[model samples]
Target: MANLPTLGQRFRRGWNAFLDKKAYENFNIIGGGYSGPNYRTILSTNTEQSIISPILNRAAVDISMIPLRHSRVDENNIYKGTIDSGLNNCLSLTANIDQTAYSFMVDVAMSLFDEGIIAVVPVDTSISILDSSSFEILSLRTGKIIQWYPRHVLVRLYNDNTGQREDLTLLKSSIAIVENPLYSVMNEPNSTLKRLVAKLNLLDAIDNQSGSGKLDLIMQVPYAIRSEQKRELAEKRLAALETQLKDSKYGVAYADAT
Candidate 1:
């Protein structure tokens, strides 16, 4: 009989497959807000139009949009600082953007940056493509040249279809950049299996650690509430992980390995 793959091997396979399927060319958006709804719209639209579009040949574009929450200086400063602090550390700062919406644009951008999937940069209003073939972005703000060699580029308009004609110039001059084409995918919640596995993995990690260390780490989380509440939550999560680990169908392999 063929040997069954170990849990570690399965995890590695899953992780590698996820990365291979998720690879994307870099993208920079000219204008957009970073609100939760805005991020949802962008993600949904991109997934529908670019990632899964039949006409586009299922091309993946790694999108990085500048946040409208800060001014030019502030935006530049924030991005530069993030770059300096190292991408992995940016998760802590994302809570400052918005906790109520955990997966907002800023959070997604930070996650992408962490994965080295894309870069987030600030540009002034009078931005234009210098070379379509080479994918050069010229920032009138600082006369600096930003080069992006993505398979495609797209412009997201806030409102009004009248301005699309003028924006078409920006699209025509650029490689694959185009004004918003009205298209979308049917929104669906994540699969229960995926969500369960993610939660189980997270909780297991915490549970395996020493109690004091886990509590210290939980307390350091910016969005986490009071100490007692955090402790209770950790206990509950650990209990849940234990329960799932006991399940034969979902976690038997993992539990056996541990």
Candidate 2:
């Protein structure tokens, strides 16, 4: 009889598949939040650390992709579970840094989760059709399940003739759902959260810097194209000048004199 694969083997297999899939999107942009009424006053009066004291103990900007785990309590109130049980279904943005900063981030994430500000499930990227108002996703790794009901869905399209355009739609019925306080800070004009998101996105764009100290070649495409155009224009002008000189009567005289 053939033996089944070990738990470690299964985990390794799942992790490899997840890496191959590039399933995680930028959480900083997609993650919802709202600032409380006292946020403005806090910013004005508190220090940087104090500002994030509600969420974080230290100010560190690191990016992390964490898988969500499911846990349950028994009648005795003892929690028992396996991380692998939910490995397949969803991942969260735990923290930006390594294990050194993991605990801090996890604390913040859990606090946020308890407050019902944001769900700990992975961001759903595959739902292209809006036929149903809500849907459930199961993780292939852990066989965990997460239900999603999008309130607003935004899609952007680029057209050469028309430039870039956005289509924003309200997906759900007009029912009041408590929004995450972080979203308010995100939407506020000239807010720290907005600045942080911009910075994080910029960092995300250049996340894969090579050992040769080179950024993505897509960034250099515009300059390369411009250079090629200039070279072609210079060549055309030189060709025209040569043609003019050859076509003139003075051309023969000049050639003979030379």
**Per-residue lDDT for 1-258 in model 1, tens only?**
999899998987755645664343322333333434332223324332232333322122223233223222364455433322322222223322222222334333432222223222212122334432342222111011123334432333222212121111123333322221222122233465346556766887877775532333221333455688887766666566557656747563221211
Clashing pairs in 1: none
TM-score of each candidate structure, all chains considered together: 0.18, 0.22
Residues 213-248 of candidate 2: C-alpha lDDT, one tens digit per residue: 332322111223357776676556555656766687
Cα lDDT of model 2 overall? 0.37
Model 2 CA deviation exceeding 4 Å by range: 1-68, 86-258
Error of 2 at 159 (Å): 18
Q: What TM-score would you give candidate 1 relative to the actual structure?
A: 0.18
